[model samples]
Structures are given as C-alpha cells and as structure tokens.
Target chain A: MKRAFGVMNQHKVMNDQDVRRALARISHEILERNKGTDDLIMVGLYTRGVTIAQRLSENIQKFEGTIVPVESLDISLYRDDVQLRIAQPIKPTTLAADISGMKVVLVDDVLFTGRSIRASMDSLQDFGRAKEIQLAVLVDRGHRELPLRADYVGKNIPTSLEEQVRVRLIETDGTDDVVIVRSGDGNNSNG
Target chain B: MTLLLSGLGMVITLMVDVESNVIGSQNVNAAGTNRKHILDVDVLSEDEILNILDQTDAMSEVLRRDIKKVPALRGRVIVTLFYEASTRTRISFEEAGKILSADVINMSSSGSSVDKGESLLNTGLTLQAMGVDVIVVRHPYSGAPNLLAKHLPKVSIINAGDGLHAHPTQALLDAYTVRSKLGSLKGLKIVIVGDVLHSRVARSAIWAFTKLGAEIVLSGPNTLMPVGLNLVDGRANVLPPVSVQPDLDDAIRGADVVMALRLQNERQNGGYLPSLREYIRRWQITKDRLSSASKEVLVMHPGPMNEGIEISTEVAHGGRSLIEEQVTNGVALRMALLYQVSAGGYQIEEEHPNGQ
Candidate 1:
C-alpha cells in the first residue's frame, strides 16, 4: 500500500522473516510482562496497527493457548492536528470485547512523535475503563514529542526529521518489510 | 531561469500556507471545503453524498459507545428553525447537535416571532445576529430553506424539510439505511410507494438514490404523483433510469427496496385524493403485495406513518422494515452533515466576532 507521504530512496530495515521473529519475541515479552495473557485484551490502532494486534493475538494464542480478543481503534477524530489536514474521513472503531477491568494492550506499526498513540489513548477512555494500558509497537523511531514510550517494540531505527519510517505488512501492503525513506533522491515508489 | 522559478514557487507556497493559516483560524471552512448550505440533494455530487454516508457510518459507531458524544462541534450554536410541526426531523437534528456537544436551541414557528407574521428573512437575520452557526430548517412552504440560504449566507442552512422541495437529510439517512442493508445501491430497484406528490421525503430520496445508481420506480395514484413527474431525473444525469409505475404491485416486482411514503391526511380534505379508505385499499403495502418483490427486499417509511393507510402495520414493523433504523441513522446522518459543515473551521467556546 502507498504510504501517506512522499518517499525518496528506500532501505529495507526488516524483511518478512525479521518481522515474524520480532512479533514472536514481542508476544513472548508481552506474556512475560503481563504474567501469561490472562485478562489481556489487545486494541489495534487503525490501518496497520490493527493487523499487528491481530498477529500479536495469534502468537499469544499459539504460546498461551488463550484467544486474545483484538479490536480496531480509529483515532482520526481525536487527533490534535485535525484542523491542519484536509478532511479526515472518519474510520470505524469496533471493540467487540469490553476492556473494563482488563489489561488493554495498544498495538501499532511504527511509533514516531507518539501523536497517534496519544490520540488512541484519549479515544480508549470512551470504550471502558481498563485495569491498565500498555503500548506495543512494531518499530519505535525516536522522536518522542509527548514523553510517551511503548511497552513492547520490535525494532528501533534511529532517524532524522527528514526521514520517513514505513512498516509494510503482508495483509495490507502485499509485502512484509520495514523500510526507511530518505528524501531528495526522487525514488518515490510506494512500499 | 529554472532555478530562480523553482525558488519563487517555494516562496509562493510558503506565503500561501501562512496566509491560509491566518485566515483558516477565522473560518472553519478554511481547512476543508464544504458548502455552507445544503438546500437540496443536487448540491452534493454522488461522491460527496457517498462520503457523507461513509462519515455517517463512522458516526454510527459513536452511538454504540458508552458516552455517545464528541467534542467536534463544542461551543458551536445550532438552531433548529422549524416552521412546521415535526417529531423526528427536529428532534433528530437537536440530538445530533447535542451529541457533538454543540449548544442547540430550538425555535418553532408557532410560539416564535414567526407567528406574529414576521418575515422569514427577518427571522433568519435575527437568528444570524444571535450567533447561530447553523440552522436546520423545516418550513411548511417549499423553498423556505433555499430562501434562508440565499438571505443568510454566513450561517450554514440545512434543509430539514421545505414544503415539497426536499428533505435532504431524510434522503441521506434513508440512503445510509438502504446501503447498510442491501450493501450497495448500484443497479438496485427501489420502489417508492404512496404520496409521492406531497412528500419532500420522496423527492429527496429520488435525488439521492438515483445519484447513487439505483433505478427508481415512483408508485402512487395519479393525483398523488408530482406534476411533470416524468421530468424527474437525477440533478445532473448522475442517476440511473427513473420511471413512474402507477401500479404499486408492478412497481415492487423485482425490487430490492420498497419505500412507503407517509400519506398525509390533509390530502384527503384538500381533494387531491378521493378518500383515505380508498387510498389505503388501493395502495396499502401489504404482505401479499410485497411478496412480488425480491425475496430479500427491504421496507422503509419516513415516519409519522399512517401505518394502515400507506403501509400495512405488519410490513411497517416487519423484519424487512428499516423504518426504525432510518430514525437511528437520521441522527448520525445529521451529525455527519454538521461535522462536514464545520470541518475546516476552528471550534470555539464563544461565537466568532465577525459571525454574520
């Protein structure tokens, strides 16, 4: 799928196998942190985040023999920069499982600036009160604007302001790779 | 020369961006574009209608939440300027505005300055002066909302129902309801039965459904069909074929959606129709009549329904009926419209100093 922004030349940071291994490790880490996935419900931010959450749930199922419920979270309305962008089409936020008194794990693809995660956190309040909230991300690029950190991370690629980090999943983009895009080369091909 | 021109272009882009930010902070429409007035379905293209419905779908999810409210329109003032008596349309608009955390005030013609023979133009001007950001209008006369739009260009005007002209939101909600049930409107046969002559709902529905690629069959008695009804077409030929099927049974045949319009009791006294008894006998949407329609055909009614008059009670409350769903979607659809109107604008705790 096409990334939202313009891309220049791309460098593969993680391939298909690398993504699978990272997710498996993250799932294990989540189970370890939460003490075996009981009362754990996973909520994925829209687009790629939901897919990552599903993958984490499947891994949890495989390891703990427990089905972790996953729900999609759409934070388009809750974004702070809503007035700066062109009309943000509202997306469906579906949570079939109640998060009340359960440990809610928020999953996403690449965490940069942490604005989307912040908005997701604000939106999660309306669903129900979770016992605790945890953030899980596939890649954590260090540009934290809101003093937020993910509890789980797949990989951390250091990047500058001019670079764009994109995590492509097989379900959405028909490819499984994490790439860093450097600008000005005009290599604008989609991920 | 190329380098110099590119440098100039960058400077111009920066200037424009800065200019837009300064002005955008004043008017909400600066960030996004949405027409201030929605007087008719023709104002929205097929894509625009579809987008609003898509937004409505998202808004529907908000209804499912524990706290079914949003701060999207907080501090905005929405006035339901209703000239005619209404339950669904007025309450729906009010609920929608409240759901978005907007300060909504209600104004009906009966108890308001309108009863004193104050002109609509004057009433609209007064409301505009009162810092009303948007006016959801439902007037007995057709084109009242259009007049409000023409006179009050600053305040957003939404046509709730204006005489026989249009009930655009009803159409939108109905279309949303239909699409939710049938999945897609394209190539679907929608038979609109009863009182098409006097229904703004029917007119608006035709405009909306036709634009979305549904074939329309208008079914009613000759007296109840609009004059020059044959001329009815999608605003810009953005619609599929529209035909009049006087016979209700034939109209419903192979139909994917069977929409029953409310039969006005006033039409009987007006001599536009012979009698309510005769009308119901000939046109009531019974189970047997609907049997000829597609097996999975959906039923609908814009309510305050003369249940046994235009539609059989069973059919109105039947499993195939989307009547209640339409009411629910009505709130979401209006909320979507309000959100769209306020999209580019900044939310404020107080009225804009320059608000008209």
Candidate 2:
C-alpha cells in the first residue's frame, strides 16, 4: 500500500547497534546453514539490498576467513506488477561468476508481500540453474502473498497494512536503523 | 471600481483553470502515461529520451548474458508491419521482441494482404482482433504510425521508419553509441553528412541530438539539401537550430562526431545528383577528411552503406567507426522501447485481500 507523506508517526524500531547485532546474527545463521561458504554465492536485490548483502559477506569473511562471491540482481523486468506503477530506469544486474551448481542466497532489506523476492527468483533463473536457492531478509513484516518464507530473518516486526517498515543503511541512506511509519492517530502504539 | 476589480478576479481564475487543463493533457502525453505510442522524436520530452537511454543500459546487460531471453513480455504479441523493404531495422525489432519473449510476427507488403490492396486500417483492425499488444510499423508514407495510433487506441505503435519524416529508434541508438563513447553529448559538435532531402534518419537525428544538447551541422550536396528546414512541419519552436554547411571538409573540421548517411538510390530518381562519381569526390567521408575532425572523433553510419560513394571503406572499417556497435545497440535500444510501451497502462487488478 502507498503511504501518504506528511504528519505521520515515525518510530525507530531498530537503532544502529540493534541493526548491527541483527545483521551479525543473521550472518552467523547463514554461515551455519550453508556450512562454511563452500560453493556459496550471495545475490542481492538492487539498492539497499546490495549493501546489506555486502555487510553480510564481510561478517562471513571475518568469521570463516574465506571470501564468497557477491552479485547484484535487478528484478524490474521480472516484476509481476509491471503494469501497476510508472516504469523507472533499470539498474544493472551484475553476476560476474558462474552461479550454476552453487547455493544462491538472495538478500534484501525488508521482506513484505514477497513479490519482490518472487521477481528476484525469476530473474536469477535466466542466469543459470543454481544448486539451491535461499532467501535472507533483515526484516520480515508478515503479509506474504506468495508461498515464500525467508531462511534467515534479522527481525520480525509484525506490521499493520497501514504501517511501512523502512530500512536505512549506512551505505545507501547514510545511517543504520529500521523505522515504522504509521498513518492516522499518532498516539496509538502497539509495540 | 469594485465592479471592475471583481471582473478582473474572475478573468484570472478562468485563465488559471484553462492553464491547468493544458498542463494535465501534456502530462498525459509524456512517456509511461497515456502516451502509448512513439510516432516521432519531435513529441518526446528530454526526460523521456534520457529515460529510454538509461533503460537501454540495463537491456544491454541482458544482452551480455549467456541466456539473452527474458520473460518480460512473455505471452505478449508484437507484429512488425513493413510497407517498405528493410534489413536491419525489421530484424532488430524482431530480435528485440523475441529476446523479451514476445511472439513476433513479421509481415511485408509484398507477400501479405497489403499486396491485395488491403488498407492500413483494415490490416490494423485484423491485428487488433488477434489481440496483438504492439505494432512496429514502417511505411512509404509519412505519419503512417500516427494514423494507426489514431484508429487503434488499444495497440501501441512504434514507428520503425516512416518515409522522410523520422526514424526515432535509429536516432536513439546513435545517441546511445556516441554518449557511451564520449561520456556526454552536451556541447559536442555532431556533423551529419549526405542525403538530407530524403533521409528520415537525418531528420530524427537532428531532433534527438539537438535535444541532448549536441550542436548539429548538416552537410551535403546542394540538390539534396532541403531549403529552410524550419518550414518542414512548422516544428521550429521545438527543434533546435541546425546550421547547413555546404563544405563537408569545413563541417568535419573540429567536429566531435561525424555521421555519414547512406545515399539512398531507391529514393533518388529525380536526378538529385549529377553523378555518383561527382557525389563521391565532393561528399565522401574519406580517412583524410576525418583526420581534420577532433582526434577522438567518432564515426557513425546507419547501415546498408553506399561505401565508396558516401563514406570510404577505410573509414567505415576504421577503429573510430561505431557501425557494428550501432547494430548491436539497435537491438538493445529496441528492446528497451518494446519493454517500456508494453509493460504499463493495463487495468490493474485490485490489491489481493492478503496484500500481495
């Protein structure tokens, strides 16, 4: 749902330290699930998702002392809702290394509705058939319309349809935090 | 005094209402809105051109992948209706549509029902009945795509090339090639040589390059040059001023990009030139002539070149020539256009109850 701007209630759900810890925990979980980065590749959706993926890669490299390949995927072409919105300029999808026979982990900031993840998965298939495909998201605010679930989630904020979860990272937005903007009566708080 | 003041206020309010309606209609004509067709570059805003170029970059990335096919327009139908013969434009449009997974059907006037005197309107209605999403059209008459657009409100019309009027896609690819090489087109000198009288490519290039802030200079034989181009369609207000340089060498000197147009033999039955030899000697883009341009000057030609007659083989095959890259970019550029026009403006379903 499109949120109307101005005079809305903004609540910082996760601060800088909280974001860092959640990403660190998610990174450890990814490492445990994939078993030491062997034949592992990270593919991040464009914009903020790419930076979060890079941070996860750094955390993994520090823990395992091994570097994993990171790629960026732009799913604008694969979007199911191409007719719903105005067309924006497409960002380049870079997958330098071959992804065949590798465990591909798709990373993103917030996983809501799961439509973007669906589009990302569709885009990844055109590159090559992966050995396996997994998804990692920093926040999973329910309301998934697709039969999809994240393997590693940083936080679960359980948001209402009128609320929006925004992830601000240091690389893209010059900060690290997650906020929920609630529309209507500003005094109400369910947290 | 009070009565006169009230009358003035009413007039001002009415004027503001009229101005807003005009602005609203213009917004509808902008790309990605109610503008479902691309008939010419003259109607395209600067932002629309930039948006198309930026999208072409992403399409180029798709072309580099091993599996060049994307399901962007899957299950959609695109028809290429050509009233004239072409090699590259038709093939490139077909390739672009297929790359996006659109089922492309190619029809030519020679073999199709068009040969049986089927009117363009009838042909369009037939395709519409088949539920084709887009029509890439090329015709011998100018404004053919516009005519199709007027009648078929549901179908998107992309003008491949229409008479001596415009070839917007070709001009776009040309701009993409130059911009990729030269970083930016702003304040650069672009010299277009030869056959300006019957060249749709040149006409479109004049609008596109000038819109991108490149100064355009038209240089060709006197007989082939149109007099007072401003009078062509009364688009002088929108079209940037272009100078006609009769001396090809002078035009090439200090130029940033030199474009050579094919001397169209099929359209030149009126003795527009005294002889091919004389045309070659006076207007041919030889390596020596190119040497006078900027050292990093780029060369371009819209294909099926008359080689020795308009441009020398050495220059066409030279390191600076972007002829082949233009062909590659042509497919990518058309892919961007096909994707943009086909994707938007559908009656979107209401959001799922679960908010998908």
Model 2 misplaced regions, further than 4 Å: A1-6, A183-191, B1-34, B228-238, B266-269, B346-356
Itemize residue pairs with steric clashes in candidate 2: none
The DockQ scores of all candidates, in the order shown, are 0.26, 0.41
Q: Pick the candidate with the highest DockQ.
A: 2
Q: Candidate 2, which CAPRI tier?
A: acceptable
DockQ of 2: 0.41
Q: List where candidate 1 sits over 4 angstroms from the true fold.
A: A1-18, A81-84, A158-163, A181-191, B1-37, B116-119, B125-131, B147-154, B229-240, B346-356
Query: Tens digits of per-residue lDDT for model 1 on A11-124?
Result: 788999999999999999999999987889899987888999999999999998999999898786676664444556788889863678999999988888888888888878
Find the 10 residues in a row with the least total lDDT in model 1 chain B: B9-18
Over B63-110, each residue of candidate 1 has an lDDT whose tens digit, in order, gives 878788767777789999888889999999999999987899999888
TM-score of each: 0.82, 0.88
Q: Which model scores highest in TM-score?
A: 2
